[model samples]
Target: MLETEKEKVKKDAEALQLKMYINGEWKEASDQKTRDVINPATGAVIAEAPEGTAEDAQAAIAAAKATFESGVWSDLPATERAAYLLKIADKIDEKAEELTKLETMDNGKTLREAGYDVGDAAACFRYYAGMITQPDGHTYHVADPMQAMVVREPVGVCGLIVPWNYPLLMSVWKIAPALAAGNTIVFKPSEVTPVTPTKLLEIFEEVGLPAGVANMVMGAGPVVGNEIASHKDVDMVSFTGGTKTGKHIMKTAADTMKKVSLELGGKSPNIIFADSDFETAVDYALFGIYAGAGQVCSAGSRILVEESIYEKFLARFAERAKEIRVGDGSDSKTEMGPLVSQEHLDKVLSYIEIGKEEGARLLCGGERLISDGLDKGYFVAPTAFADTTQEMRIVQEEIFGPVVAIQPFKDEEEAIRLANDSDYGLAGAVFTVDGAKGLRVIKKLRAGITWINSYHPTYNEAPWGGYKQSGIGRSLGTFGLEEFQEVKQININLEVEPIGWFEK
Candidate 1:
């Protein structure tokens, strides 16, 4: 975050011009306008991508539609599609180190976290590759001469809008499954962070994915994203971002009656019981909200502890949070990095002020961090508040930053009540030594994914989604592949006996 660091990143930025990929080639925006890509850590311009317009988005959609209808890739054997996906996975693994560094520089996340994202992206591609080779439908026999079977088919061209939190990982969450289902893609990466997605397009080209089968267009939400949602040629839209934007996309895609899948915001809860392991619970509580500087959609931003241990746990948690390393993401020792942008940093700081106005007690870390040469970076200290009520905005809303609120509950019933009082139910966690108690609490929590004695540990094989306002559909497993497919029932007659059943 020093001047020299900014100069170094500026030099790197000058070497690359991130362009849009469409119709098997890289090009500029239709208007030839480009936007600077910033390194959040140093507040430096690291690269530039096209400020694509509606025309660019439409072009990508048209290319995908043509590829899907032409059957150049969609009609190929499932195993062959799997082969291409597997090769992409390998390529991702090959460039894992470089991609990690790029992600760190581009998104202001620690290099360690970026490495995990890269690894997860590769695993997601490989997971979908295996899924595509499995049987796809079910056969049914109806009494005498009737037979029927249901088969899954591609849902034509898909529009994918990914968020900036996990730039490459979120893209793979959609891209891997969409490709495995033999559907063409027109993807729009978050304009704030497009470097990794641009690199992903290079991998796609190197893997020999069929021409026009996949395209990447980078721009703001209203221009590129809305175009993808409302374009008539696009048959489906899969979006991951804030709840408001997801709702807008759903409404836009409704014009064409397109299939839609969404993964939105969360105000997740992490409830710790008196019977939980003290040390491990404390560690995971930190990991839940502090990792990625709490930009994750499923961050356990609200912590509920049993009244008996509330004071002790909160003290330890607050002390540890103050010690979290905040600096340039390229540093291996840095545990947390800057917020993704100046706007987001401001938003998080405003919420901290709101928390104080609501009379919530700030135990530690309520101000922006400007120390150890991190003055130029948009850094915020990991903040925690206690004596917060469910009605407080700090406890009820998705701060989406390194800010968390802790509340105490009287009993198990009250714990569940406090956890489910929010409008968002994306994910939650329970920390208890008793297995039966864990099951009881988890079954009652209204969340798509819940962890026992753990938090934020997701698997590639599991169905990832939320129950209520969190999302409309699932991703990351068999359920994810099904989202990109359409079901059709075929009927046949085995016996055609001449029995004057109908008057001819």
Candidate 2:
């Protein structure tokens, strides 16, 4: 970018004044305090947002509860609600470029990746809008003079907390479904990446959503997040972030007996058999761990290869890993951008050192990339480790960076065994030309999301979540809409008489 253009963006960014959205109004922090939002790629303060406190969170929650009770949005006919949602989707597309730039600028993702997120977020809203029109209740046949039925109802106030990785997309994942299910929400985006998140509320306003139907409070998780999770008025909490934080939210939310849904960390495996198509397997293996700088929750961070082709796979993978262009996210030629923050970069580098100490061989690009003045930003080259053992920390833990652990297995049984051996059952993939074998492996893998001969392709039509400690519930498709709904079973007796035992 030219110096003049850069200065203009910075000046415009400084004017952001990230206000909170409550009761259909934009307001500042209760204390009138604000925090600077930085450009992760340049380490420049580009914008400022409210430094909300617990009190601010409480105000948002109270508004949502009262609005829900008023039935302003909850009582709307399904078709009308769908219309509101579709309008929001249309608004998102109209502002896609603006939203995409903010996402790339604030979160340090390549423009292409950020662009995809914008489109997907819009698609998410449309998907749920259509879903709201579908049948969501059932009736059952029973004995004469008696009737039974099951129906879906909104779960009242919902607290939605999204991670910084895909700020706009993740928030929309929870927001669209909650709105479709007729639930009010108090939403929180990652404090460090609040720019793109605030734009969604603007879209809500433009689309004429009802007051207090959706609110946003931005601040540290300890204060605002804890308030939302533990608030008695917030009926449920849906969080997507680290496992440790997810556990904390789950425990705190238990006090109010609030329903909790968490999409947590993962160390997913990508299994490639000897019979797999060689070039395709090698290409997707790189795409799996390196995309998003390997910060994805379901990132395929571990690669378990069949022994016969293991060496070839490692060679091709390392060759391609070194060639990935790492630089400013705005540069269209840059294939990968910096990590979201400096602190996260340090954590990922420390993991590389730990891998070395654990005796795992560094295959390629383990150090921070300091070329072309990239050292000013938090950039790390695509990294890989070979000969990793199942017990190694790098292999077992969720690195959440551009790091991959490549291990060789002797047979299909061992490959499946190694893949299933993890605390996270979030996602995994098997690449093989033999369709029957790939199907068998996919079935045997222990994870909520799995793929055959492909990696990192997700659909709004499919359920997304994990097993074991990864998460408690699913997101996307019909399941995503149901997450914010409570089921009720109604029974009626046609006859006016009661049982004889009651009379006695």
Candidate 3:
């Protein structure tokens, strides 16, 4: 961008104020503090978000609690709630262009990637809208004169905290389901990318969603997010972020015994066998890690290849990795975009250095891009370190960047062992022409989402989460909607008469 373009963004930032939405009213923080939101693609300040504090977070939670207790939204008929969700979904579609641009500017993902996420966000609202209308309670058969049945109700206020990697998509993953289930919400979008989610709050208001049905407080996690988690009024917290932070939230939420659903980090593995369709395996290997700049929680950063095809596979993967176009996300021709922020780019670069120090082979690009209009942006080339061991930090830890740690396995058994050796069980994929082997291997792999010949195709109808450290509970499909609900058993007596064994 030219000097004038950068200056114009600064001017826009000065004019725009992303305020906090509470009780259907847009307001500033109590102290009137603000934080400049920088565009990672251009390293320019695009806008400013209200830097909310713990008091602000408390106010949001109180509003959610009050609204839930009032039953204005929670007690609405299922069809009514469903209609609101559908409306929000429709609004998202109507405003996809604006939201996508904000997402790209705030999160530094390609326009196409942001566009895909915007579509998925809309689908999430629609999915929950339809799912909520389905039968969820159960009728039971009992003995004697008693009739018993189970009914579901909303679980008061929900504390929704989402990550920056998928700014809008992740927010909808929690918001739509929480609303569909009739629970009021205290939402906290990541401080890094609060722009898109703030716009979502607008859509919620535009659709006439009741005040406090969905409230947003934007600030640092320790202040706003922790306040929501530890608040007694907040009944549940559905957080999607790093594993360490997930653990912290679990501990804090345990004080109030609030239900905690976490979708944490992963060092996912992508396996390629010699017998697999070679071209397809190579293509997905690139897509798995490079997509979202490898910032995905379920990103396949660990590529485990069979010994027979290790050398051939790594060469092709590295060749493709080097060619991924990295620049401003708004550029239609760019295939890859910069990291979300300068700090994150430094973290990814440090991981690359650690990979080299640990005696791994740098087969392709590993340097930060400082030329071709990318000098100001936080851009790094798609990097891969081959001949990695399981003990290496690059192999075990979640780098959350366009960096892959490639390792070779001797056989099928070793492949399975290598895949499941991580502390995370978020996602994994295996590529092989043998369908039976794919199933067999995938079954043994300890992850929540898996693919036979594919890489990244997640559905809203299916459960989305992981085992072990990946998360505590599921967050998509029926399971996701159920997370914000409570179950109650109601029994009625068919006959009022009773026989007494002892004389009165």
What is the total number of backbone clashes in candidate 2?
0
Model 3 score (lDDT)? 0.91
Candidates in order have lDDT scores of 0.92, 0.92, 0.91
For model 2, give the RMSD to the true fold: 3.5
lDDT digits (tens) for residues 1-504 of candidate 2: 112223433455445767899999899888776777778788887677888889999999999999999999999999999999999989999999999899998899999999999999999999998989987688888987879999999999999999999999999999999999999999999998999999999999998899899999999999999999999999999999999999999999999999999999999999999998899999999999999989899999999999998898889999999999989889999899989888899999999999999999999998888778887788999999999999999999999999999999999899999999999999999999999999999999899999999999999999999999899899999999889999999988889886677655
Off-target runs (Cα >4 Å) in candidate 3 are 1-15, 499-503
How much is 195 displaced in model 3, in angstroms?
0.6
For candidate 1, lDDT tens digit of each residue in 1-504?
A: 112223434455364678899999998888777777788888887876778989999889989999999998899999999999899999999999999999999899999999999999999999999988987799997776889999999999999999999999999999999989999999999998999999999999998888899999989998899999998889999999999999999999999999999999999999999999998999999999999999999999999999999999999998899889889999999999999998899999999999999999998898988877888888999999999998888887889999999999999999999999988989999999999999999999999989999999889999899978898899987899999999999998888777688999
C-alpha RMSD for every candidate = 3.2, 3.5, 3.1
Q: How well is each residue in 241-360 modelled by candidate 3, as lDDT tens digits?
A: 999999999999999999889999999999999899999999999999999999999899999999998899988888888888888999999999999988899999999999999999
- TM-scores, each model vs. reference: 0.97, 0.96, 0.97
